[model samples]
Target: MLQDARSVASRSSQEAEIAGPASPEFIDFDRLLAAVRRQWRLVAVLGLIGLLLGIAYVMTAVPRYTASSNLLIDQGSNRIVDELSTSGGSIEDESGILSQVELLKSDQIGNKVIDALHLTSDESFMHSSVSLLRRVKLAVVSVVDISSWFRAPEEEADDEAEKRLTALALLGNDLDVARVGRSYVLSISYTSPDPVMAARVAQAFANAYLADQLDSKYEATRRASSWLQQRIDELRQKSLETDLAVQRFRAEKGLIAADGRLVSDQQLTELNSQLTLAQADVATARAKMDRIQSLLESGDTNSVVNDALASTVINELRTKYLDAAKRQAEISNRLGNDHAQAVRLRAEMENYKQLMFSELGRIAESYRSDLQVAQAREAAVQRSVADATSVSAGANETQVQLRELEREAETYRNLYQTFLQRYQEAVQQQSFPITEARVITDAQVPTAPSKPRKPLVLAISLFIGLAAGSALGAFREFRDRFFRTGDQVREELGLAYLGSVPHVKDKALAIPTQKAGTGTEASDRYLRANNAVARYVLDHPLSSFAETLRSAKIAADLAISHQKKIIGVISVLPSEGKSMISANLAELIASHGSSAILIDGDIRNPGLTRAVARHATAGLLEAVMDERPLKDCILVDPETKLALVPAVVKHRVPHTADLLSSVNMTTLLDEASNAFDYVVLDLPPLGPVVDVRAIAPRIDAFIFVVEWGKTARRVVRSTLAANPQIAEKTLGVILNKVDTEKMKLYRDFGSDEYYTSRYSSYYHQGK
Candidate 1:
């Protein structure tokens, strides 16, 4: 009971929020668990699909082989030659030790291997020999033939040799390289079906590199020798030309040859003597010219005459000195003899006069001597000077020529020496046993080829397959709209359910039966024998949906008799237990042994007959039209003591809606209530038909039966408003088809999650 109350309260609270087809809107883990439980079969099927894909992947995939070479790339190898030095060249190293492995992988080395192994093919080998389509074919074909072909052959081999060559080339491609650690040893591995081919390919790599190193050394030697010979010839020519120039100069000058067959020591010594003499002459000339110019600049006013002028040159010189002394004396007389500047100037003037007189004496003597010497001797001296000048000019020209020859010769000599040394070194290196970088490890041929993981592909396909299947199942679950849960009936309609009639999967449901007559009340009796058999559903006052149902029913029964004689049946949609309402009410009332007659007034789709079985006829139609008398038209159920009027018609006319709502229907309603204890009318939904409006005022009160979540209160309210006075006689709502299990849940909780917030408040307050 507590559990049912909690469920009702929870549904009521949830209905306040989203207003859904109310069970408890709160989907607890249990309900979710239930939904998942239902889908477990689907999950299992999908899982099986996933497993199949995984298996398929494992079965159909191509086996992939990876051949890796382990190499110890010595990090310290770079430092190996930092301490080594050549005469003038730097250490020829590219990270010395580690780069050895890289060189093995170099195109130069690899190309050598390719050439030695003859791996390059003309056209077909360039593109992938096996691809996705080809692989699929191979996979399919491989199923039948074990040794068909590793890869499809492009052109059929013409001969055995060609076939073997092609096979070898195909197997050669499975080669790879890598550094293992900081070790110096490298392990090279190649992948191929033939183990011999793998080892051969690795050995081919080492041989190719060794051959390249030897070729490099030989080429280097050849180049060096060629360059050196050319340089030696050029230098020899220059040396000869320099020697020839010296010889030619000596020959042209008629100079004595040196003891060494070029120029003599005596000739050189003589040239040096002449050079000194010439230099002395130039110095003397320069000195005289400078003195003459200095004299001119000093403005020496005193001059001395020569002996030929019949003058005492010395006396003239002395007179000038005397004049200078007189001038000095006059200045001294005026300014005093002790005056420093005047004294100094007088002394300087006297010294200048003495120097002039001395120089005059020397010049007079020189002039006499010049006159005495011959004019022929002067001419001869000029000739000697001219000859010396010509020789000096010739010598300077030779010096410039010598300089040019020397510079050219020096340049060639240096280059010749360099090339000679380089050539010598190359010859030396070639003579010795030079060790070149060699591959230590051969490539290991891989046994398996890598690609086309079939198991993984199949696994993915299976996953997709299962997803497709489960989605289909879920879609069916969503499309079914029968009142799936008892809570849905109660909450959506603002009504509560009395009970659920569990699905009795009886085969009898399929048996077609003639529509029962008014005497068919026996079925109802079997259905409801005890209150326990009735599945009494009590509403909780704490539940909002129950409150809504409570409000709607109280409003519907505002003007009712003690027994609530007037009953207004409504449903959220058509055929939602409204007919059930009429039947059950009659059954309940009749059980009290109070006279009750059920009216089948739903002119359209009259299903009251289906529920009561006694009224599935045109008796109600006959009575309204005055075709049948009340006593004859009325039906009395044998088992339930409930009377049913049947409108069992031969042909159902369209105007039955109008006839049931006519004044005659009202008169019939008043008269039937007087005759029987209670008259229950099974009207069509207020939405579908309007027969109730005409008959409602005569009713004392009404009872609305709503399947738990199947009916909406707003619909009931609107239908009630159509006959406002009768609507007031509503005796409250009865929730039909309530699930006992679900009812217990909300009843214990007493609200949905939204309203459950107050739980803490109340719980804390209680604490």
Candidate 2:
């Protein structure tokens, strides 16, 4: 029979393990939502803290006003000179506009503004709020003399230099330069504690920038003019010397040519021109002659060749040939091929055509004659040019030297003239230089501060706080190693989750069944509340808690069949409500019309004994020691009619474990098993002592009780590991003190309509 109960308990444990709550290893959105919902107070508190911080910042922060001055940079061309044109077209390139922005922020303009405004002496400008910390640090450095450890530090700068550097730094920090989109416009903004000062500085920056541009242009022009002036004087002197040298050499050697050109120079020029014309004439005549000759050979008549046939004899021959051909055509049209008149006309026309051929040959000969004359003229001009070149070569070496000197003189003269022209332009530009950039919009007095954007800061703070709070909540949830759900027990510890017992509010109602009519009003109220909770199986049998208890009962029945009814209830830690489970389980078995005995096996803390038999002097210990009869130690509850063996001893037992494993105790359990259909022992917490281990072998199976969301996994695992025999006897773990309302937060856990109680109001509709 005991073997059968063990088999049933083992089978029940396995089934419970399989049918536990869903594990968190899978996606569980409901669990995450529940976690956030449960920790909302923390989120709200953190958000409030962030909001307060934002408010403090707004209250304590200094208001800074930003005044912007927009300047339109006409980058198309330099106003001073078109020679200094830029590649900037209608639209400015990214780099071009960015460079303009950089120019606006440059130190040159910064220094100019500083000097113009005399800001170097302004305390706020020299030591703005932005560098207050730095100023304090400098003050400290000036006072401290910690040069003993290291080499002596360098001496500080004079007040003027320090003030200048501080102003520069402050100016840089206060200035903001940005391009206005893709346009050739720049926005120069200045920030200051004083609104009017900000506006003044911004406007001054634009003015200073424009003035700097004009000054630079004028300076460049002045420098150019100075260089040109010096260069022009040098060039003029050099030109005069070259001219004098040329004239002296020409006079000394008489190598100067009239009209600034030698006879050979004129001859070469005239020869080259005539040679070109002669060559062109020869080519034209040759081409015409070739055309006439080709026409004569092919027997083709053309007007161009008629020029070669300009002879009177040829003209008469051509006219006679045409008259003869006309008469032949007239006769051929009037008579047949065999007619006498047509034959005579044909003979006459043939004779005339032969004469015309002779005349054409004469014209071709004339064209050849003209081509020869052109070639002769070309050769004559060539000879004249050669003679002229030879005559010029006979001139002395001084002539070449004179030419070189003249060329040098002319070159210097041109350079001097060019420099003189540029110098005049430069002087004119220096007098009035134009700036490329202009102020599109002047800086206006700022009406408000740009810093301390309250709403934006508050919004950012809220987001950060929310993120931090959520992270903290998640961290806490992750750090917790307890069994938050029955699935944790099943998945992590590989233990079966028998069932969960909802947290009972009224402990008095959870008391073991006592004698009827002996209960007071307080006890009745406690009983009612308990009936709705821990004792739900008796009063609210159809409730979720009751259903959970019945499930556990079913599992116990499976693990321990009718033949083996001796079961032990234990937990890993105290306050797990194992005693209550044991007592209730006993009552459940008794209500099934089976005799069930409940025993308090925990001698150290006799919870069951205190609840069932408060005034009893002797119980398990005395019965085990044979100091009292076993029947005298057993108490029968009148309400449940279940037999109870409470551990109500007057004095503590030194060797409680030894007493529990004694032969008398074993015999007592054996007799109780025989007398009752079911025996339940409320054992000590498994984690706190080894008493449970000693009794583990005596009991058929154990109902391992654990407080839901409270029992640490490490404690349960370590306790079970330390006592392998007890672990083996454990039928399954019972999760006590479950928050059912909280469980509904996880959609998957309590989505069932039955658990939600769709008709919950039906029970109290008439009550």
lDDT of 1: 0.53
Give the Cα error of residue 454 in candidate 1, in Å.
10
Each candidate structure's count of clashing pairs: 69, 4
Per-residue lDDT of model 2, residues 1-767, tens digit only:
44544454455346665878535577566667777776777888888888888888788888999999999888654454433223322225677677767877888888888899999777765555554676676567656847634654466567887677677777887799988776778899988888888999999999998998788777766766777788889999998999898778767764657696765667778888998999999999899889878877777533436564566775776677677668777877877666788788778767766666677777788889999999999999989878877767766454767778879999999988987887777777677777788998999998978987889988888888878787887787787677666556655656666666667676434333433454553232121111323344555455555555566667667666556577888998888888878877877777668788889998899877665566565678778886567777776655556777878667778788888888888899888988887888899887777788787778877788888777788888888878877766666777788776765543344433225456454332111
Query: Residue 293, candidate 2: how far off, in angstroms?
Result: 61
Runs in model 1 deviating more than 4 A are 1-28, 56-483, 486-493, 509-561, 568-585, 592-594, 608-617, 655-660, 677-767
| Maximum-lDDT candidate | 2
Question: lDDT for every model?
Answer: 0.53, 0.73
